[model samples]
Target: MTTRINAVPRAVPAEEVEVPFADCYITTAAQHAALRVLRSGWLTTGREVAAFEAEFAGYVGAGHAVAVSSCTQGIELALRSFGLPRGSLVLTSTMTFCGAVQAIVHAGLQPVLVDVDAGTGMPTPATVRDAVRAYGPPAAMTVVHWAGDLADVPALAEAAGLTLDQIVVDAAHALGTSAGTTPIGSQCAATCFSFYATKNLPLGEGGMVTTNDPERSRWLHQARLHGMTADAWRRYLPGGSWRYDVAEAGLKANMTDLQAAMGRAQLTHLPAWQHRRAQIAARYDTLLAAQPGIALPHRPALGTGTHAWHLYPVRLAPGIDRDEVIAELAQRRVGTSVHFIPVHQLTYFARIASVPPAGMAGADTLFGQLLSLPIHPRLTDGQIDAVCAALADATHRQFTRKGAS
Candidate 1:
């Protein structure tokens, strides 16, 4: 008679150390394309760049897409394309990256900051109108897609009573995002996208400027390469003219062929990657909602568009210090981060709004409560479970019985 074998019970392996957030989804296709770019002798501003630009332009539903060095540069170029007068009033949300502020300043425009919605972290259309009215006629309004959530850009543009020339979108966080039926890049005069390593669709460090105006598009193409009338390759190529003209002092901000190769590969897989992002976001919503003090982000009821889900920032209970919460979470080996510290809260914005820390209630309050958990696509089910459990423990640790630590 054969003895039946019994399986021995084993430890659950300590949940595999939970998970780390923000894994870049580079595929085999990307690797192959990168290798191909290396093999191809002509690397800088080659056919790869054109192919990637065209593909991206089509994807974003824009007439032109100018690949640049970084999103910040794209924003600057967008502003500069208008050829705005120095000190022209420009309005943007106060709750934004420092790059937006710098873009305005660098373009020789005066930034007139406006407050964002307390809950949504977006500038309301009314606020845009009011800011423009108060600050005098704005040369342009740069609406950021905060947290990969598209602001009410079309409505804000409409309220300004200005042409599309007056609308530029700092869509650094909005690659595969859309506002209503139109994609994020299609709604404004110029739309800038970042491919920073941490960004949703990363290309190490690169950016794109999509626009409808042919003149603006041409200017951007030239501007990214020392304002040269022709590309360097064209100038140096066999049977090419030695002479060229530099009309303006343009910034050196061109995307290399290698970066374009990576971008092209990323773009091919962006749809699928974004699909996983949405799935992860939904999972966060379901699991995190059970925590009593956590507040979730709200999508517009009327908008029929895809949220890129680049960030999954949840607001913690008021009165609970966010730093303490983060520290406790870190002690539990949970990876967490904050979206931003508002622009006005920085020392530089003191001149624009001398609002005290307490008075800048909207931003200060939000900063103290927001926490971004691990929501990357690489997360496994068990890891996700562990993170949720860790969060619960942290929350309970912070808010339990008489608010004892």
Candidate 2:
């Protein structure tokens, strides 16, 4: 008798799942913290914000953490703190949310878009060198940790022939990420994190900047407000004088006490939440491993660091219409999203930089193939299986249609 083997059956959903591309995980403790802040009668930046800053600083192992209104503001403030000359060129990845480039432009600096590695959708040291060769040396560089995967900042700086102080990190997706015994926030000159609703540590809306430089930390605090010598909490509280003076022009980017309270509560649950995220990612990997025309997200090398798994993005093989697949998943009640369109492809940046479509081949190719799947603490195992089943069915149908045509 001939030996026989059968492929394992893929799990199908018992019923349709209304999976969303992103969802905020809110706990009862977070709700209580928000209520406590509301009952305290102080809503703006105050004691809660201070405590949150300290707690976050300790969590990330940074010497100082400054709470801000958003990650964009944090990036702008960090860049401004460097005091780079007006119209200075800043190097940044094109495969990002565009906020970093926007921050650079808002800070009176020019942005030089660097292409990313196609495999990882993140800029490598080689790409950094290419950008430098094409656009000349930059006054500063902002490295984005795409999809919670940490980039070797030290190596990138070395490739660009710049110092650590000249490097800033846009770690919006990497709050819990680490690099072989070293956390992300403490490595660069300034590392900025987001607490946007869809982020790993959701606070609805908030951001933080971590730095070891005391002077820069102090400057960020003053600059987040009105560049005043003293904030309202300092001057209006008990034994606080009404005396203050303007130091410099600053933007109002302070995080409110309400957001800080929720952040503090959410921070406590981050480790567990991160664990769930990993579990979801692993499930996705196992379910999609045998599916043709689908490539799972790239993972960093073992012992390199831990991934935060903020977004479970996968790439579709060429000749498949990504939009059609997205529509099919939507019809099946499985929501999906594209991570980003290359910033260099945006009209404004394209006009300013005058880069052709073929200039950044890596980012361009990745953009066409990328699709973000649902990955959060709130997702159930069944929902993950449903997502994979829907995706496999959608791609198989596309392949069938192509062959028929």
Candidate 3:
């Protein structure tokens, strides 16, 4: 008989791993919360939405908060509340999501694009001033906290001669961002947040609008449910009258109880999630700061509360092609994405606003070299290291022959 060796066999060729740009963290808490809502049998905009709104308002230090179908609705409602005439100018950042600009357009207001600061990637007070000077007497101004960077809201509002009512902040990425010691929502007129699946506070698809003014809060509440004084919550309850009138032309943009339940669970974990995000972001900052042909995102010297760290975008140095780096990263089975392509560059805005290319310098420059790495609560330390290593390696391979700037 032949003696057979007991050595392990060689492995087959491994397939490329699929990495996502962003991933949501859902645990038993989410499942339990969702199950509770299911058992209650009241799934629409009911008590859950109300409770979540109250809790979120308290968390953000706002007098009131209104849960809506989406952040897009929040922005649209904020614009609608202005009662601004058709074609009235509203200044906003060029480095923002299309939804921000689209909301202005949807509300019959003309969008005036303003460039952001190169370092912070946020709309500066001067840029807002310049936009206002160019398109003076604006009906409103939407200040977007781009990629969780708190823009100079107070200075911009003051420079633009805008009252608190005229300053609506699209704080979609700024759940934990602060202006000095104050939170983002507390400083603006109407602060809108996104709980979209990819946002810092993911509710799958939901949003909130917070305001210090009680009157505005009440209006938003009614407006969220088609301007009906009493929503289905009251209409369907026992001993509740079905008699209700449509007070005004409103939108069908109310958040469901299911969405609110998820929001509540997410909110409960927000503090810890935010802390972890910051730690990861800080690590990225420290590790990536010294890399050749790489410039990591900069945190301003002001705020102490938290950064939210919704995105950790870095700018590649001159002569390094961002697309090539992204391609290399993809080839290495790493995930990457961009925060935005610039509002002014999108085809829809270009057609309607025809915003000149020259004025949006910050947005243009940043968009070409910007690439966001995977940074979520679910990412492990090893994953973070892998991302950092891949990024550095990609930069070297892409920019080695070009010479350093």
Which candidate should be chosen as best, given lDDT against the real structure? Answer: 2
TM per candidate comes to 0.91, 0.95, 0.92
lDDT value, residue 74 of candidate 3: 98
- Residue ranges of candidate 3 with Cα displaced over 4 Å: 1-19, 302-305, 354-358, 403-405
Query: What Cα-based lDDT does every candidate model obtain?
Result: 0.78, 0.88, 0.81
| Per-residue accuracy of model 3 over 1-405 as CA lDDT, tens digit each | 111222232332212334467876655677788899999988999999999999999898898999999898999998888777889988878888898888999888999888877777877777777777776767788987777876767788787788877999999999988766677786767999998888888767889999988888888888888889999889888989999988777899999898888788778888777877888798788888889888888676654444668999888887888888899888877889998888888888878873534488887888888889887777665566667787888788767656543
Clashing pairs in 3: none
Q: Runs in model 2 with CA error above 4 Å? A: 1-15, 354-358
RMSD score of candidate 1 (Å): 5.8
Q: How do the residues 164-195 of candidate 2 rate in per-residue lDDT, one tens digit apiece?
A: 99998999999878998777898888999999
Give the runs in model 1 whose Cα sits over 4 Å from its true position.
1-16, 352-359, 401-405
Superposition TM-score, candidate 1 onto the true structure: 0.91
Q: Is candidate 2 or candidate 3 better by lDDT?
A: 2
* 12-93: candidate 1 lDDT, tens digit per residue: 3433464566666566778788899899887798678888899999998999999999999999888988888888877777
lDDT of 1: 0.78
**Model 3, 341: alpha-carbon shift in Å?**
0.8
Show pairs that collide, candidate 2.
Answer: none
**Model 1 clash pairs?**
none
